[model samples]
Target chain A: MTTPGRTTAEHTAADTLEGGPRRGRVRPGGRRGVPLPLLVPALAGLAFLLLPLIALLVRAPWRDLPEQLTGGEVWQALRLSLLCATAATALSLVVGVPLAWLLARTEFPGRGLVRALVTLPLVLPPVVGGVALLLALGRNGVVGQWLDSWFGITLPFTTAGVVLAETFVAMPFLVISVEGTLRAADPRYEEAAQTLGASRFTAFRRVTLPLIAPGVAAGSVLAWARALGEFGATITFAGNFPGRTQTMPLAVYLALQNDPAAAIALSLVLLAVSIAVLAGLRDRWMTAS
Target chain B: MTRSARRTRRTLQVAGAGAAALLALSACSSSGSDSGSADSGSSASSASSSPELSGTVTVFAAASLKESFTTLGKEFEKDHPGTEVTFNFGGSDTLAASITSGAPADVFAAASAKTMKIVTDAGDASGTPATFVRNQLEIATLPGNPDKIASLKDLTKSGLKVVLCDKTVPCGAAAQTALEASGLKLTPVSYEQDVKSALTKVELKEADAAVVYRTDVQAAGDKVEGVDFPESAEAVNDYPIALLKDAPNADAAQAFITLVKSAEGQKVLAEAGFMKP
Candidate 1:
């Protein structure tokens, strides 16, 4: 389902890779014009993408906005969303970066297959991923049954479950982004450090880490944003409990059932936060390449 | 510029021709089905002696009605021959919200009068909704009842994970009413979006028990066990069915509703553990 979107993005990235410097040169001249065929549809596409967000702003209950935001439940959900998203990003960074490095830098059998499997969650529906997680980690699940009997640990319906579910769905963005960057970065720098008596791990720590910092930053932002907006998997795996697993999206969804105004108000907060983060970082890190 | 404009006009003409062909194909298929049903003999015709109700009837019903309503839908289709009955089942509040938001549905069956009122207040329902059946709350425990949960208070026992529908949904509101009537404050492990998911938590053994409709516990069939409690009497939900104001197939929608209110439909609902309205 998501393959077409990813392919289109890849094609766009390819176009940018070739068009960037040439477009820059053309900008200096300031003589050429955008073709009618492209400009008309481009404007239409921009409107189509932005109309919903604009509608959200237009229809928002502005009078009740202050009261809505001041509510304790709204703050609790927002705080949990931010906290869970950051923790999920950190978890993704810890394991995902090393996994990306291995995929990009090492030689292993069935590496292509392994990379494909790693990205399965990106295309698999989040709800299905949640069910899979439940089957694998629920108290009566295969591994979970053992965990319950031996260690007395259960993952569902807890704060930790929210982080795990978010990590399951969000880690793929980080892996794909960092892996693409690692493939683009010159391995010769790490090779040089290795030749200078630094161990492989130290070489990665000192040399490659700084080199791919922008990519890591971009990836972390993407993962954090994805985690923050996660709805299906988080609700399915972690369940909706205030101050425990109920994040902003779950809160917004349940609120929409009876209170449309409150739902819209909560949605506006999430939208504002996401737009702020994305816009603030885009110029410095996201577009660095 | 002229060449591009010509190409664009040509593209539009092609699209227009394609849409015309699609419309023609649909018209042909509908008529084809009509003729085919006419040829199926006197039984189908006699059963539907009243004005022929054809086309598809898209019913937006509450999740608790899934089992019985599905059986009723099949019976309706059989009786009407050329008609198809399609159902969209979910939380009643969700269904009402979608209907009010202009989702193209023909019939609306909500689990409670409160949810039905959401549609009627929005003027999305064509007329007053009729109560078809009622469902009582039941405690759904895992098969074999390992926890020995006999009453509502047993669910409040520590270390026991219980799931309930979100209070915004009908089942959850009813469960809340029942809990309040019993003077118990029970916090579930999770508040599921709907009754089915709450029951699923127990069926999967993730939670020790769930408060769901008796019909759902019956529908689960040995996956979970149903335990009746007296507080359920205070929270019995009345199911209501109505035709939508914008029903594309209002005739068929009306017939479907009539069938639901008919004795045959009542039989199916009773078989599924629903009570008389």
Candidate 2:
């Protein structure tokens, strides 16, 4: 017979460790030895994850990398990618945190279904998601026809469209992370503040927001990373135009078709950016609770 | 047993099972290779003497050849018993790169001479590639030609959204040749990665027009309307097919090539909007 309670406790501990830096410090004594059974597959999995990265570094056109990286087109794409990813992250934070708070703090009918719908973009193929975006927001689309006639707005084949595409695919990561953090946080602090004559909104603004700041930061970092790597949706919905809508991934893909060395160089730049972002956020989010 | 002892025992059992599985997997693979070599040796011996072909032939062809080649592949299988034909359809340049990179393909059919040159330059092809068909460019407009686009010059009209394949692709290169021949300067709303994607933009009505292959316009059926311009004759893309230098099933690959160049094969290609080379 399986012991369900014990397994659930182990799963919970594993989830917390997967949240990162705490894994290094929280269970120091538990790392004396890994059983051979787990160690073998764990090492294999590590190699599987790392071998492609090692191959990239090995076959990287190091001799031509300097000139390739310095090209005007390379910088244009990198700059666009950074700007759009940051804007998308900002947009997600403005809207997603409140949604997470609602899901965690409020009890409403069909809340479960609403939450599922919010996260639907994460699983939908980015190309399909892009098509859906077009159908709903294209020039002759359902809501888009009105926007075009009344507001003179067209979302496709522009920088703004790139941001919308990234935001569409990335916000779910922020909402899920922040919602999980909000659920884990104690809600009684808000109640105590309310009892002291603070309004519910005031209690939330002053207390709950501060309590989940770390989670929000972590979520923002994740959303930013996802937005930076967005390709299919951006290309399909926004279309690829250099200096306007071509993000690093789109540039990387196009370069791969024509110039492989250029693709590797662009990939290295993206890898460096990812490392820098994660390293920058480590101190704030990875510490033990 | 104590909980710790039980846990250790279970871990050991798992480790032992893993080792056994790995050993069995390696053993099976070695035997598989032995049988594979034996079968190939027999096939090679029969290939030199026998007129009948019986082996798997893997052909890497351009994406545009998908429908016609699939039909040809089925007909080839029916004519030759105990033979199988497999296809890997993609961009001609991509397939060329793969062949040069030592991908195990028995035959290669490229969309353009430039892409075929890559494989030939690398000395991966057995002989000079033969031109099998010629493909012309067509303006794929939304169903009913809603934008009323007629000639290539109409695409240059302000506020008319047009999409074209990226210049790296065969269709894009052909479009460029035609545009230069006509002395026209047209800016597209977007340059898609492939001909199909460019056609998709017209089908979805996102763009008023897309410059794509006549075959693609035909395949799109009621989704798009094809407009033929006289300038398309100035930039016809020739499709080339060649046998690889290191074909695993050379006999079958050769026979498959023969079938593609036959009268029946030409009928299929013509139906798919390919012109005589």
True-vs-predicted CA distance for residue A13, candidate 1, Å: 32
Whole-model lDDT per candidate: 0.89, 0.88
Per candidate, the number of residue pairs that clash is: 0, 0
Interface RMSD of 1: 5.9
Q: Which residue runs of candidate 2 sit more than 4 Å off their true CA positions?
A: A1-40, A284-289, B1-55
Q: What TM-score number comes out for model 1?
A: 0.86
Q: Report fnat for all candidates as fractions from 0 to 1.
A: 0.66, 0.45
What fraction of the genuine interface contacts, i.e. the true contacts, does candidate 2 reproduce?
0.45
Comparing chain B with the reference, what is the TM-score for each candidate? Answer: 0.83, 0.88
Q: Report the error of model 2 at residue B232, Å.
A: 2.4
* Model 2 docking grade: acceptable
In the predicted model 2, the residue pairs found to clash are: none
Instruction: Highest DockQ: give the candidate number.
Output: 1
